[model samples]
Target: MALRIPKAELPLEVRENMVQQLGAVPENVEVTWHSPKVAQDDMEFGGEVGAWDAADASLKSFAQMAVPALVG
Candidate 1:
């Protein structure tokens, strides 16, 4: 049997904070953990943008994901 390791290790402070807020460290977040400052700012910016309620969430989710999938 083989064991898998994380791509990047997160700082304990950041990891615990993520766990508290999000239940677990999400895979997408692992990329930003390399720069803890970016990770923190991303979280803050995400909090700000994520609170908007003017759009239908399902369409917002679809557009958010779909365009990335269609990029050149």
Candidate 2:
């Protein structure tokens, strides 16, 4: 599973702190920093949904995309 956190809202120092507190970072986890313009473009192209909703939609889309790869 992937986790997306808005870097602008939570700075890198905070994220590093959390990682340090956690003691271990999973291999499956990814941290991405989205620029304001790129983020806006993503929302506009996808749907105008709230964060959680957009995340759900993205996950669903990823799962669907993965089906063929998994089968082949």
Candidate 3:
């Protein structure tokens, strides 16, 4: 069981916040983000998310992130 994500894809604080919001997500389960990249209009954006616990496991995710748009 392990959590793997591309480096810098997510920050520790953001990950912690997700854990807090999504509760405990089992390891090994593959989660797919429908809208990985979202537009920030007025500094806000949202979309549906999905996670597969197993072949017989499915969930409807209403995850939304409201953060200041990062400027590179």
Return the top candidate by lDDT: 1
Clashing pairs in 2: none
lDDT of each: 0.79, 0.52, 0.36
Q: Distance from true position, residue 6, model 3, in Å?
A: 6.2
TM-score result, candidate 2: 0.25
lDDT of 2 by residue, 1-68 (tens): 44455324435664586489666532223222346455446535544444334445668888998999
Error of 1 at 1 (Å): 20
* lDDT of each residue in 18-70, candidate 1, tens digit only: 89988999875787767778877988898999998687767888988889899
**Per-residue CA lDDT of candidate 3, range 32-54, in tens?**
32223321221132222233234
My TM-score estimates for the predictions, one after another, are: 0.56, 0.25, 0.26
RMSD of each: 8.9, 11.7, 19.3
- Clashing pairs in model 3, backbone N/Cα/C closer than 3 A: none
Q: Choose 1 or 3, whichever is better by TM-score.
A: 1
